[model samples]
Target chain A: MICNFGAGPCILPQEVFKQASQAVLNFNDTGLSILEISHRAPEFEAVVDETIKLVKELLNVPEGYSVLLLQGGASTQFSMVPMNLLAEGQSAAYLDSGAWASKALKEAKLFGEVKVVASSKESNYTFIPKDYEIPADAAYFHYTSNNTIFGTELFETPKTSVPVVCDMSSDIFSREINVSDFGIIYAGAQKNMGPAGVTLVIIKDELLGKSGRKLPSMLDYKIHADNKSLYNTPPVFSIYVSMLNLQWLKSKGGVAAIEQENIAKAAALYEEIDRNPLFKSPCAVEDRSRMNICFVMENKELEKPFLKLAEERGMVGIKGHRSVGGFRASIYNALPITAIHSLIDVMQEFAETVK
Target chain B: MICNFGAGPCILPQEVFKQASQAVLNFNDTGLSILEISHRAPEFEAVVDETIKLVKELLNVPEGYSVLLLQGGASTQFSMVPMNLLAEGQSAAYLDSGAWASKALKEAKLFGEVKVVASSKESNYTFIPKDYEIPADAAYFHYTSNNTIFGTELFETPKTSVPVVCDMSSDIFSREINVSDFGIIYAGAQKNMGPAGVTLVIIKDELLGKSGRKLPSMLDYKIHADNKSLYNTPPVFSIYVSMLNLQWLKSKGGVAAIEQENIAKAAALYEEIDRNPLFKSPCAVEDRSRMNICFVMENKELEKPFLKLAEERGMVGIKGHRSVGGFRASIYNALPITAIHSLIDVMQEFAETVK
Candidate 1:
């Protein structure tokens, strides 16, 4: 089996994949493909309800938070969050650490004023900026929890008086966090949840209805929250797959258990990168992502040979982003520790050859 | 096997389901689920490219038109169409025959002036309004080609002076239409394409860049067309399934052949509805949709019994929309002729019992 490490639209549990595939063929033996069923049907409603329940149970979401299954990905959420929260003439604070954060901030600027509280662009986003002050009058403090491209993560949730809005697209459910600390937490399902169609938005109920702008029905968070994300047809198959994946997570003792596994996996790879003579990890040691582990060869020429070796050894999606040409092994929730061991073995062999 | 007749997220060909299910387990033996592959990867880029090509081929999309695979469903397009097309002080004309058209007009009003050219709501949307004049100075004339809820369709494309935009969500590929007639034709993929996560937008290339409004990148059609819908992570699995469905359509002799089959299925059901003494077709015969066949028992009390009978006979999703509830049998491009025959038989049996 190929060890796929492509960031976002990354790997899923084999059992979840199998169950999802079966549902596609014949959902619950109704002889109807999951693709053919209406979202309004009880079967689909059950999936949505169960998914929300499981999300709450797994995340230990406190009572006042609402979970919504939405579409258009986290990129759309970048615009939606600002459109729904930042009022006219008001500003929101953003902590920019990577490409996605920069994009979110840029989209937010179209809706209202934005204050860059902190950014790591000066260091090419190798670390999450620390020791920055959030604006006192800001509507919300927006931050990305993990940087997929730069392979850095904010280990500590920023302490802000303003409502905290986070784009946890790459690392949600891979670790445990206090849901009560944030006003809004959104994640595209492709990374840790399930697939690429639906986005999961968990927001505090009271934070909504504050944006006074005339918003479209689809863009309005209150409408979706009131209607329970059934305002329009949802991404049914995507939500169903996400539900299955969440069930798998629950079976594995939920997020706390998975977080431990993730920590171990990240530790194994990061340890290898630090020890291997021919390689080096570019991310700040303290802020290295447990989800996306990025490293590079000491010599630029060795990059091509190492990539080819990894590919030959059944490692897929190890190539890094085009802007930063090196390597990124994204070990999501579904990726096993054994896969990391296999990747390290390949890295060690390549180092020996280069030596 | 049960016959599915839900309006959208409706039935797909068994062959397409088999292929899609296999892809979900392992896409093309790549040892990775389609859900796991990056949107930019060649594997998924190929799916997007092929789906676009098939959409063009099936619809006979004319030159100077761009087809985009977008997320957020057609409801989002209701807002996006106005955001991108209707500028300041500009009024757009809308022909409101049913719920969806009225929704589009409602969203358009959020952006600029909207002139209701005509509406069939007085007759409870049982007929399409034909003799309305398109406002000469209107930015664009918008109408839904087929009303899924009301079971009405505009059989003839309206000739308008302004740019003509049509939401063909229900009847997109079920028949042939002249592509040159429309400035924009948008459809939710759930009904006639594959599933519920993606939307298909066909816009004239020249019509873009005239909105004069700064739009969010995700909400802007021009940006998506320019980026080939890869501006952000797309609903990869949804798009992939849609591609497989389009391929199934092509294998069944493209839209031309599928149109003939669709015609036969609708005719068989309509013929049965007319002859059966216990039932009546409520939609105007001239405007009655071939995609969604709406009929009801002459006696309202018989509705529940007939629905139960259909359900018992291994038929699913035969219940009509809650707004005009009796029964709605949605026979899209993928529904088999045999399924309709079984429905007719069921109707005949119900008539005998009532008589």
Candidate 2:
């Protein structure tokens, strides 16, 4: 079996794939492929309902928060987040820890004034910027909780008074998060969730409608929330697969349970990187992402051969991002710890071959 | 076997589903489920390229147009069409043909002054309004080519000097059209194209950038076109399935061949509706859609029993839209002509019982 580790649109549980593929053939013995079913069918409505309930149960979402299963990716959310929350001349503070964070702020600037509280761009986002104060006058505080490209994460919520909005595209559902602490939390359903078509947005209901902007119905979160994410024909198959994946997550004991496994997986790999003399992690120790582990070879010329070896040995999608070329093994909720050990074994084997 | 006549996210070819399920298990023998493959992967990029190529070939899309496979449904396009093409103080003409047409106009009004040249709203959109004047000074003319709910279709492009935009969601690939005649053509893939999740957008390269309005990157067609639909992560599986479905269509001959089948199917159903004492069509005969044949009972009380009999006799999704209150038989490209015969048989059987 190939170990899939390529960034977003990454691996899901094998069982989920089995179920998804089966649904494509025949969904729940309904005599119809899941692809051919209408979004408004009672069966599909149940899928949407169950998926939402699973999200609430897994995240420990509070009473006032609305969990939305939307389409487009986190990139679309970068635009929608500000469109619904910030109007012209109103300022929103941003923490530019990585490429995605900066992308979010850039879009925010087009809609409103953006205050850059802190950014690690100069260091190529090697660490998350921590020592910054959020302006009270800002409309909201926005940050990318985990930087997939930079391989760093902000484990704790930033201290802020303004409504906190996060783009947790890569690392959501890997650990426990207090749903009530933020005004909005959105993640593309590609890394830890399921595939690349849908986006999961958890919003604190009361904090909405204050932007007072005449938003297009699709861009207005209130409309989507009010319509229960059925404002239009949703991404039906993607949502269905997501529901299957989320069901797998719940069966594996939900977020709190997966957090333990993620921690162990990260620790094993990070320890291997530190111990193996030929390899080193470029990211700052404290901020290294639990989801994506980015590391580089001490002897840079050996990198291509290492990738080839990994691929030959049944390792798939271990190539690092384009911006930061090295190797990134994303040990998400579904990646087995045994695969982590296998990656370590490859590293040791590579070191031996080079030495 | 069950026939899927359910509106959007309706029927796709059985062969496409088998291939899709196989890809979900192992895509092109890559040992990775299509769902897990990165959008940036070379193989996935090839899928995107080939899908665009097929779309161009099937639609006879001329030069100076970009075909983008993106996410969200036609609802997202309802916003993006106005956001990218319309600016404040500028006026755009709209033909309010149906509910979706009005929804598109609603979004356009938020972006600019929308001049609805004509509407049949007073008659519940039972017919496509004609004899409306096109405002030459308007920036563009927008209309929904097919009304899935009201069972009307504008087969001919509206005679307009201004650039034309169309939402061809329900009947996009069912028939042939001159792609060069419009400034933009978009469709949610759930109908004739593939499944829900991805949208097919064909944009005239020159008509963009005239809006002179700042658009969020996701809303900007140029950005998506320039990036070749890789501005961000696309709906990988949806696009893959679309490519598969399009290949199946090509195998059976292109849209022109399907159009012949569609015409035959619609003609059969409409002929029966007119001849039967129990049933009659509510839509204007001139404006009747080749897709989604809508009919109602002459005796209002027989409606429930007729629908129940149709369902019992394996005629699924014949219940009309909520707004129209009748029976609709959506015979999209994938729906076989034999299914049409089966439905006619059911109608005849039900008629005999009622008499």
Candidate 3:
């Protein structure tokens, strides 16, 4: 069996793919592809409604939170979150953990005063900074829950007086969390949810209409909140597939059940890296991400051959990012435990042969 | 046969839909669904490469024009185009024709001095203004190629010394034209290309870098152009399906052949509306859009029965925009001539019964 470790736009639930394929040919017996349906039509509306409802139910989001399936990736929300909430002089605090988190901090700065309360850059982003105090007067405390490229995660959120905001792009739905702790939680659908094209932004309704900044129609959360995601045409096919994936998550006993499986898969891979002499993980032990695993060899010459052997065994997409070159294996929400074991087996055999 | 007239996220060719369905299940036999592939990987890189190539071949876009498949829809570009190209002191010419056109004008005003060269607001935007002078010193002449809500089109582009920028959101690839004439052409894919979430921007390479503005990474056209739409994680599935639609357009004899069919379909429906006293075309004779035909009854009371009968007969999404309070039949590229005939026959029968 081939194991896919592609970082984002990685693996999806098999059943979601099956249902998505069926819907493409005929949706709701309408004799039309889901791609061909109008968002304003009732058929497409049902897809949007159910997807939002499932997201709220699965996350156990509070009564006042409004979920929006928007276009662009989480990068767009980096600008939009501030544009809709932060006024000219008001400040927001952001934690810089990795590339994506830093990019969000920079984009948010364009709209208002963005204070970087904590940063992990000094350690090459191998560790998450702790004990940084979030300002009480800041509008929100922005953080990235997981960093895909660097293989790091913020295990525990900072104690902040302001409302918490998170970009849970890489590790959403992989663990249990109290949804009410966040004022906003945004995620790009490409990582763990469904396909690319949609960004899920869940926001507390009371937190909105306070910025007093006149935002463009597309950036205005109230417009999307009032329209129920139908103010304009939405990504119909992507949202439909996301709903299917959520149903698969539900069938598998929701977040609590998946969290246990994720822990097992991550532990198996990390254990091999720790015990094996040839490989060494790059991230700090406490901050290592459950989703992405980054590792390197004591002797750099073995990296290429190790990757070649893994490919021969039908293990793919393990090359690390150019920015931080080595090897990476992303075991996202849909990555089976069998795949992780197969990868570990390959790694052990490759290390033995090289030695 | 069901006649789909829903405005956007609308109809696509059956062949395109079929191919898209196959790719979603098994993309190029990678043993993974298309939704599960990484944008940075070679498999999806090829998809993006071939898509840009096909767009150039179909449009006859000039040598220097770079095609970018971006997210956030045409609404985002309404602000980004000006943000990237228009400097604070330099002015841009805008033609206000409809709701979207006016919105574009408003966004441009936020970036630079906006010159309203022409407007059809006097007639409630039922006609396109003529003989307006485009400023020679303006950065670009911006206009909406086809107004979806108002059902007006610029049959012939205006001559301007400055670069011509167009928002072809509703009518791109529905007809043929010289792509070289415009400095930039942008379209939200929901209308004629693919689904929502992906926006196509074809920009002249030299026209950029003149604004000297510190654009955020997401809004900078130069960044995406340099990286070949990989400046960030793109909307992958939406872009892949767009490639299928473009391929379908090529197989069915490209834009020139489809333009002939489009003209015929528009003529057939408009002829019926003009000849019958019970119904009347709302747009001016010289400004009618070939893609979207807006019509109303001589007596407004007949609108309800017409919509009801049409919906019952599987002729869906025919009610006009709420702003206009009439009826609109959007005969886009994927709309077959048979559907137009069905609508025309219904119009004749309605006139006989209602009169």
Candidate 3 chain A weakest ten by summed lDDT: A208-217
- lDDT of candidates 1 onward, in order: 0.92, 0.90, 0.88
lDDT digits (tens) for residues B1-355 of candidate 2: 6877888789999999999999998999998899999888899999999999999999999999999888878888887887787767888999998999999898888888889999999999999999999899998899999999999999999888889999999999899999989999999999888988999999999966668888888888889988999999899999999999999888889999999999999999899999998899999999999988888988989999888887887777879988998899999998998898888888899888977
> What is the per-residue lDDT of model 3 for residues B1-355, given as tens digits with 9 covering 90 to 100?
7999878878888888788788888899888889988888898899899989988998898898899999878888898888889987999999998989898989888788999998988889999988889999999999999999989998787888899999999999988879989999999998888877789999999977668987667778998999999887888888898898989989999989999999999999999889878889888998999988999988898899988888877897889998887899999999999999899888877877865
Interface RMSD (Å), every candidate:
0.7, 0.8, 1.4
Please, what are the lDDT tens digits per residue for candidate 1 over residues A1-355? 5888889899999999899999988898777889998898888899999999999999999999999999999999999999899889999999989999999999999989999988889888989999999988999999999999999999789898999999999999999999999999999999999899999999999988788988999998998999999999999999999999999999999999999999999999999999998889998999999999889878999899899999999999999887567999999999999999999999999988977
Residue-wise C-alpha lDDT for candidate 1, range B233-285, written one tens digit per residue: 99999899899999989989999998899889999999999998888899999
Cα deviation of A132, candidate 3, in Å? 2.2
Model 1: which residue pairs collide? Answer: none
| Model 1 stretches with alpha carbons more than 4 Å out | none
lDDT of 3 at A214: 72
Clashing pairs in 2: none
- Model 2 chain B scores worst on lDDT over the 10 consecutive residues at B207-216
How far does residue B218 in candidate 3 sit from its true spot (Å)? 0.5
- Reference contacts reproduced by model 1: 0.82
User: TM-scores of the models, in the given order?
Assistant: 0.99, 0.99, 0.95
